[model samples]
Target chain A: MAIEHSSVDLSDAMILEPTALADWIITAPVIIPLIAGALLLMIRHETRFHAGIAIGALLLALLGHIGLLARVLETGPLTMTMGRWLPPFGISFTADVLGASMGLAATLSALVCALYSLTDIGARGRRYGFYGFLMLMMAGVNGAFITGDIFNLYVWFEVFLISSFGLLVLGSERRQLDGATKYAILNLLGTTLFLTATALLYGALGTLNMADIARVMPEVQDSIPAGTLATLFFFAFAMKAAAFPVNFWLPASYHTPRIAAAALFGGVLTKIGVYALLRTFGMLMPDQLTLLSTLIAWVAAATMIIGVMGALAQTDLRRILGFVVISGVGTMMAGLALGSVEGFSGAIFYAFHSILVMTALYLLAGVMNGLAGTYSLRTLSGLYTSHPLVAAFAFLLFLAVSGLPPASGLWPKVMLIRASIDGGAPWLAFAILLSSLLTMLALGRVFLLAVWRPAVEPSTAMVVSPGIGYAALLVLAVPIVWMGVYPEPFANVATKAAAGLTDTSAYIRSVFPEVVQ
Target chain B: MQTLIFRTAAPYISSLMVLFSIFVTLRGHNEPGGGFIGGLIAASAAAVYGIAYGVPAVRKALYFHPMAIAGSGLMLSALSGVFSIFHGVPLMTGVWGSFGFLGATVDIATVVTFDLGVYLVVLGSFTSIALALEEREDG
Candidate 1:
């Protein structure tokens, strides 16, 4: 049935259309983690077995995503409706190149984190459903990336939040409980805002399918309370993304959890918020986005400055990394604010690059925590002597995180800067460069204090054995260097993904097939 | 201390509620009663029984941890989708089949399986949480 809302143009309406190629692969990335998580909960006492299952499930999903990415890149977007129903009536799972690539990156990060958890997560944490919650969080991230409906996105967000809440409080320490309380309260507020926006949008549009909303947005752009809806969406996603003025929850709570959970959250969680922002503003409301580009640019600049300044003041390794992740969000937001093809492509590439780099950085932070028996920089030192490999990986990831040349982070910054100049927003470019400079100083201070200086007390001894976790960290580093050395293939994929986002007619057509006579 | 009269009636009342919950779950295919509501009904029945008997009694009756029930439900829900792949449909797409037993015809679909999963997951997770809280109070 066609949505016959008065605001929708007859020309834009499409009748009940069936999907062409029902690719089950489009849904596997989400379902695999979900099923694995459920199974992990069943086998809770078998810690080693749970670890194996978690890592295996993530690897399977990663492979599935790789194949799905290739297919989507080759044959446009893929769409499938649940329960064999048509698009509007059923929940639709649609994955374009962007979604597939993001899914791949997230799954890869999760796999590495799971591998690290083998050594890191204690028996108590394992008994408390660590792997289950981790897998659940991964499932939520993948589901959010692939779903084609707004309400479905909300459901996935809740899934992400609930699992993350459990994972955050896995240890049940006083600190963890405190962190979880703040995290749960703030995140729940964001969720409430999101649900409010969804209710309002559905009330106005009479449709919850994203493609249908995008098709009808132009018609109702002026008639409805578009600005308020847009603002609500912006705040909701911004709170989740940890953008400036609403990012305190991240640094506060992120450091309270164990390294594995922290690494997963650092890598994939907030990025989902960024992905949602791109999908909603970049695709669903291009006209409004164009109108608000200047506002977004200022917000981007402020987010970059505020986030870096926040990082500069932090002494805890995880907290510093947490703030750095926020700055990375600013960089991506800058690209999005530019609202150009080059800008969008830069944002997409940076999104994936940041995922890998931040996850690697956090994993290295875990190794550092092992080396010094704490996460505080004041108590950490002499890592270059005792554990050279961990120090080396941390240094390299820092360079990548701060956008130094010959690192993956530099390429995205270059594209974003170039786009800003061409798009007549050089100030945004300057904001990015300034943020990178400040981030370098902040992180460089971390390096000097944590790596160069001698230990505050030479009597402090290293804690645990660095097993395959170090290898897992190094494996994540290889892709960062690979992207830096050979940026062409990655750039091409990102450009295609950006093109798909800028033009959603293919996505719309894929999800809502042409109605046959 | 257990109230003799309430304790005496709890078993019969709880058994009926659980049976009613299953009926509600089965009718959810075309009616308003689905897995979530049915599961909540079942959990409340268990909670009422626990109030009369004790946390230990409810735990013994459940046999498996409530969280395990939730996990199994999740697996069932997800597996229902995987089954659709074998039928050459998209993920989570419903595939229907019919069978006759005892000279009566029975219809089944993947959606029903998914709903049953949801039911178990809700019933188990909620009851477990309630039991945990009630146990904490006792301790």
Candidate 2:
């Protein structure tokens, strides 16, 4: 059945597109955090109370996003035009099921990260500014997912970057400074490339909106250099996503911060890059994407293997989790490369699942390190006996992250495997399975060294922080089971989100009306 | 050698430049001036202050930490987006209304809010880097 929709026709006549309150609701996911972030900056002096405000803002944003998700599910994709300017003249915000769902997930993750930071950050330093930066990062991630304008995506990237720099260096320790410098320099380079690509795309398409570019891209094949522009966009996203060769920046830079900061970066930052990749290639430049998908698949395979290998080599607890998170990026991108509905769905599902699982794992690692004194495997032991509750939660998160049964990670892997087999890429499926097994092995190693090994010298005792870390752990832990046990609801949302992404026509119709021949 | 570099650049040069940075941010939307450039300029101004004056002097002169300013800028920019919802528009959408500016109508758009957000973000971010580097130098 054809979806009944209304849109403005600016090509010939200036007709107002029929819109709804739902449009406003869909945009709330981004709006709430943005507002909260602004409110947060005003009262930075109340250092003691800033956590409350930050957590409150995150909770409100989560609620607002949940409300938006409900409306989008009841309806279809929701679209809003900025400044009442007609499409092609003004920017648009589109909340397809995927964008809103991912947005909600991002907000929820940020909220937990904020809670986690309360204890994690306070112990390391007293930087009240981190909360505002966290809020800004959330705003950037949410904006990137929902934005239908290409240039706005770049703006959102900057937002995420600026805040990220603060969070990375919040402690101002020697290691943090070094890591932040590297992180900042690499990300700045990525931003430059991204801006160049954006300028080139605008020059090629004459419009900066994604939907407009998609509509005009096919027509300009003969006149413009689509291949060159597509490559530019692809390379920029690859660097941002940390795919293979460009992936070094992530593991090198991410390990320097406190657990809460690391958790947020692990969960949200890279995903923004992944989201851009999926949106731009899957929607805007579909034909050119097919040509590049094979190369991306190889890169995905390499990233997976290398990331897992890197994880195995790490002695630091946060570093291991960091590598695992990087490896998972490959799995997500692999599904995107497959270019099948099931593959895309699996990719999006994996992304949703990984954010929860990885964030929880990092928090759990933080808890262990807090209790055990040091994050080094050689330094930690008997965590299971001393902190069984933490062990159980970490174990569950481990199983979930490793794609083991009774958790959400399994289903996405299953879907990805099936998609690969159906596409006749048995080697790709083999690679994914091998990576999953290796991921399981890597985490198992962490579990062994961290939980099962004999207790070390009695002088080094684990001191668990009260209130903040435990509270954050509880907040993140609940969803790992909820999403795993009853995956249908979120899975449905993800499928809808994936479908919205794959169907460029629907996106076009939402942004611009069909020009009369 | 380092002190020589500091002595070469005038002490007021940085503060004067910072004032110009604020000007760029304030007038961003209509002209080429916007938050990113303005923030960068402000940051450079602070960096100059750091070199000409001692790091501690620069820090004391600012009164607030560089990171705090960045945080405040981020908040301001984000507030601009949030304020649009009261007018029944989407987040980050430019909402235009006219107000009397000395008997002349002035357009207040949401883009201005966004620009302000950008301004704060750039200002806060760059200053933090500058301050962090200064602290490293002292150590």
Candidate 3:
């Protein structure tokens, strides 16, 4: 209890008057998929219908998120509490530009993944609740991105985690079980740390609403070990984001699942952790973020270098992509470590870029694997001649992910590196540059060996994949190419989103508009 | 162990526990019991029945796949929240209604429906896990 807060508070902070009906769109992103997912459960065995239902649900969610982003951009920020309860007592959903854009990116990535699932998943997989898990996971991811309640954020984490556990083990393969085990143990530790930190945070601040905590953080900072709490949260989120030291879980397990599931994990899952870190530090406690920036910078450097190195050493295409995913995490973490508006904006932009490009890469992996009848690079070759269209898609995603020109990945990397150098961290900038080079090399090698090299005699005939898989990949690829070509609008959104995060006044005020006076 | 004495009494014990679970669920809004705890209690009843008899027997008695029940429970919970959208309020806003029967008022609320959904989810999820484990042991 901030005994000090209640005295000066607007006595009416706890009450509400009737609002416009259209305001309900705030929760539509989460609610849409949740209802659809639950409905899909009743008929879980109907694989034929599952893909359509999942796609429809995801499209609805994507539209809702697009609407939310547009609204937040036009307005400043939006806030809605569950059950019409007052702030601090009821869980609130705060949608600022950052959260809305991320939600939109996540929903779009998920929709593409769902579409890919149609080609990648089978009747047996569908019967086991593939689409249902995808929807539920999206619910969790979107909820976490936008929730204004820290405890509710934890709940959303569990929602996604449980659904991911289901997604990871969809095939019941030995490799999947082995991978899921590592994924489970480490992730469980992360959640436990998250919960413990949340409890301590609540104990320190006497509130679970995120904005109120920020409002009271300055006063509470002196008495509590905010650093320790921050460390706990950092580690928890780092593990989730697959940052270095605890990131082994991602590369180990992601490659084991269906490529569709892996795509979701690679593209959207770890980004949740990154989003949580940015939201907590950038918005909730800017001082702690500043204090911890040096250590974060070191982590960022190590992650970038190590992640790319790991990718270079892998021969399996999926495994190589897994490490590539980790490398992207390092780049985003660099953005956080810099702690500038450009840095945050760059990170946000990268995250959206990463979601689209990474998911597309994974979908391409599925397509390539389908055609080659394997994920092994050693036995695959001559795709340039045999499947030029598929090989063309692969080349575009490669350029995009490697931070090359004419692709979305280039802009964020530029912004982040420039911000790092400008912020007086040349070494951090160097690490990012080094990672980009190594990433380009590693991925280019994948293309050279798997797609362009002279024909290797096929041990087996290529598996003809469905056109839907290519469609899904195309959906994800367009944004990367378009955003690259038309960077001004998207870059503007990223900057606006970052501006909201670096200055917490707007975010906090969204939650407690009356507290401003 | 599926002993004779336990098997003989399992049915009656399960029935009583289920009845108590419903009581707990209904009273949850005003008291300590809610869908979560009530569900656990109901699940324990199912587990006890499975221990005395078998998974097939419990499955037959239940007459539905446990996961299906869980899924429907989720739908119900979501719909209860959506009920507020019809009233032009934020999601999960509770709406209250009352009916008169023989000059006595009967109150109904979306909150209870949400709680009941939670109860079913807990019951279904726990029962399925317990049944799966037990069935594996038997086989």
Candidate 4:
């Protein structure tokens, strides 16, 4: 794909240039999914067609996102001002390397999840509404990453939350309903806190723009009563990210959804919270971050240990994976606490890796449930015999999650550990290593029970659709290995993105040059 | 007699409430009223309609599906942010233009457009949930 750069001279009276056609790449990822979602709603009667269109839209989104990421990498950050208004007043859509890369990861995961749903859920029942909800959720996740405004982030959160509510309850089982209520209440509380934080930030600074806030923060840091507000904001994001002490709702709520839905939720949702935490701390309040870093580090350690313990106790495959997601959250945060470039890059790279590995693991679990007629560990056995492909894919993902060599997970763990050691926090490094061990143990238990054990009743077998299952597995599996093997490009981009976030000077200059005044 | 009162009072009250919601949504940018409040009002209207009439009856009267409304609202709100492009502004930048109408100056902008979108989305989502739960109970 050819990358185009456009610049309109703003040396005249206006502070910024109007948006050009080049801006389309920034907004297209959000707009396309939404348009597809609206189109799906119109054809609610045609279940298969809706599912196909939804999947196609996600595929197109994934491709388009890659193209956009290429453009951002070739150029610097790709920014499009809304309605052509300048930075302080209007909302901006930024395709920074980090945001675009996350968007790409999310879109790919959604695409695989969509495909898996078509086979798994379609076999069980017709759910056109579910497809529609899935599309909306995709739009929310994409938009949240790319948006340059805090309030816009909140809106996207609601967009995703509303659809998630629908997906969580689509099964209408009693457990699903109960879980949905708890999920709904907790998420609502989180969003409300997020909204209030936005309001408080806006009130403090008179601006809601992320770049603009970064510019203004230093002047106000001393007079603005920073610590308390910062704590509130941290708590709010931590709740959303499902950090320790606030993470109970995730495992409780996630396991009740249909496996396909649960896979997407596990893969994409918590990352948004983590993304927000990283963006806010790294960009908006870097000065105060030092104070909070210790607290955040402890949270990461606790979340990691607690998450694995929770995973070890789970008898169900989906629930166990859900808890594993919780544990991995700590690993991702460890990089941020180290507060070094290597640590930050490792954290971000690990985040990207976790998105793929977790989704693949969950997708494999969904396939297992489809084949074995149950997700219970007691009921499932010896999938290596009948479903060798599924077994192989599951084992690959298990290795990836365990941070074993030759897989994507190992590199990020290595980088994080190195960063921890360099930062003189060997204890943190040890905690990460310990967490990895527990994760290995937790996943090892699952692999043994799900893949190695002999099937108790060969007669009671559920037929797995080889075509879709293999396709879905390949979709995620390829990236897991490719990224693991050749991670330099991603690492380079992540380093630049992290630097851009930390320096804040490039972001500030981009939004407000000396000429603007 | 109570049923008669509900029958007599519900439609007018519901209609008035929806109209008020529109008012709140339109005025949201300058003042406190906006899409969220408007959506709540409209959802309340739907609930009252549900109670006065049967849930099925209310759902039938809602010609547009709730989810569709919510989805469209989301699109509209997002589009409002994009609208800033026309005036050479960034996304979600507020733009205002005024025209004289009916011996008064009338102003319109993307923020109001966004609020209107929010109204539709909130109304659609809340009402859909209410209607779904009502249907479940009926069954």
What DockQ results for candidate 1? 0.55
* Candidate number that wins on TM-score, 1 or 4: 1
> lDDT by residue for model 2 over B52-122, one digit each (tens)?
76678777877876656665666666666656667555455455677898899876666776786677667
Descending-lDDT candidate ranking: 3, 1, 4, 2
Task: Please state the error at residue A259 of candidate 4 in Å.
Answer: 1.3
lDDT tens digits, residues A198-239, model 1?
A: 999999888889888888898888998888888899889989
Per-candidate fnat, comma-separated: 0.65, 0.38, 0.68, 0.48
Candidate 4: DockQ? 0.31
- Expressed as tens digits, the lDDT of each residue in A183-209 for candidate 2 is 899989998998998898877778988
* DockQ class, candidate 4: acceptable
User: What lDDT does the true structure give each of the candidates?
Assistant: 0.87, 0.78, 0.88, 0.82
lDDT score, residue A10, model 4? 38
Candidate with the larger TM-score of 3 and 4: 3
List TM-scores of chain B, every candidate: 0.95, 0.81, 0.95, 0.90
Q: Write the per-residue lDDT of candidate 3 for residues A1-517, one digit (tens) a residue.
A: 1113236664354334654676777888999999889878878876688888889998998888888889989978899888876888878999988888988988998888887777778899998999889999999999998899999999999999999999999989999999999999999999999999999998888998988988899887978989999999999999999999888998889999988899989999999999999988987888899999998988988888899999999988889989998999999999999999999999999998999998899888888878878888888888899889988898899999999988889999999989998999999999999999999999999999988897788548657664887788778778999988888888899999999887778777777777773
Clashing pairs in 2: A38-B75, A98-A497, A371-A462, B28-B33, B70-B124, B73-B120, B77-B117
Number of the candidate with higher DockQ, 1 or 2: 1
Q: Give residue B27's lDDT in candidate 1 (0 to 100).
A: 93
Q: Kindly indicate the candidate among 1 and 2 with the higher lDDT.
A: 1
Runs in model 2 with CA error above 4 Å? A1-22, A123-128, A466-468, A513-517, B1-139
Write out the backbone clash pairs for model 3: none
- Candidate 4 runs further than 4 Å off: A1-16, A123-128, A459-461, A515-517, B5-50, B72-123, B126-139
Measured over all alpha carbons after superposition, the RMSD of each candidate to the real structure, in angstroms, is 4.0, 5.5, 3.4, 5.2
Quality class of the docking in candidate 3, CAPRI style: medium
Supply DockQ values for each candidate. Answer: 0.55, 0.27, 0.56, 0.31
